[model samples]
Target: MTAPAKTYTLLDAAGRPYRSTTKGLWGGHRGSRIYGRLDCPTALLALARSTGYAHRRVFFTDEATAAAAGFRPCGACCKDRYRTWKTAQENGERWNP
Candidate 1:
């Protein structure tokens, strides 16, 4: 008999584990310490333009997890949000958005 299928699990923003049936939930860049929506056009364009882009692509279960990992919002797609976060950092305020 065939063995039961194994389920994939990922960490939440709080680092809790949860089952993930499908991938491609969120995208991140390890080099830049940034993350954004999977459908972000800027991220898609960057991925298309680079040869080793796939290696830099990281996935997160949710935005909270991405933020918790110290990933800032993408500047391209999340322009306003990025600006706010940057401003907060510049003013020495804790960023939480």
Candidate 2:
């Protein structure tokens, strides 16, 4: 039989690596440190551009993982969470959302 497919490992909120057969639940832009759903419009548009967004694209197992990595939620797609994060930042409160 052929060799089995290699599984990918992604980081959890605590930065622990875990194996997964599928891609992570969230995608992040390394430069901006922003995370969003896999189908996020901004990501899609960026990827479609001439330069493409793949070079800066990162993956996270979950929102908590992304947050722990210092990534904020996407404003275009995650409006509510972005607002919460922004408010927390402006008020000097902890960013828990």
In terms of lDDT, the best-performing candidate is 2
| Candidate 1, backbone clash total | 1
Model 2, position 29, has a per-residue lDDT of 84
Estimate TM-scores for all models.
Answer: 0.74, 0.83
Cα-based lDDT for every prediction: 0.78, 0.84
lDDT value, residue 27 of candidate 1: 83
Clashing pairs for predicted structure model 1, backbone only:
13-65
Task: Give the clash total for candidate 2.
Answer: 0
Clashing pairs in 2: none
Measured over all alpha carbons after superposition, the RMSD of each candidate to the real structure, in angstroms, is 3.4, 2.4
Candidate 2's TM-score: 0.83
Candidate 2 residue-wise lDDT at 18? 74
Cα lDDT, model 2, residue 80:
96
Query: Over the stretch 42-92, how does candidate 1's per-residue lDDT look in tens digits?
Result: 889888999687677777877767888788999888888799989999999
**Least well predicted 10-residue stretch by lDDT in candidate 1:** 8-17
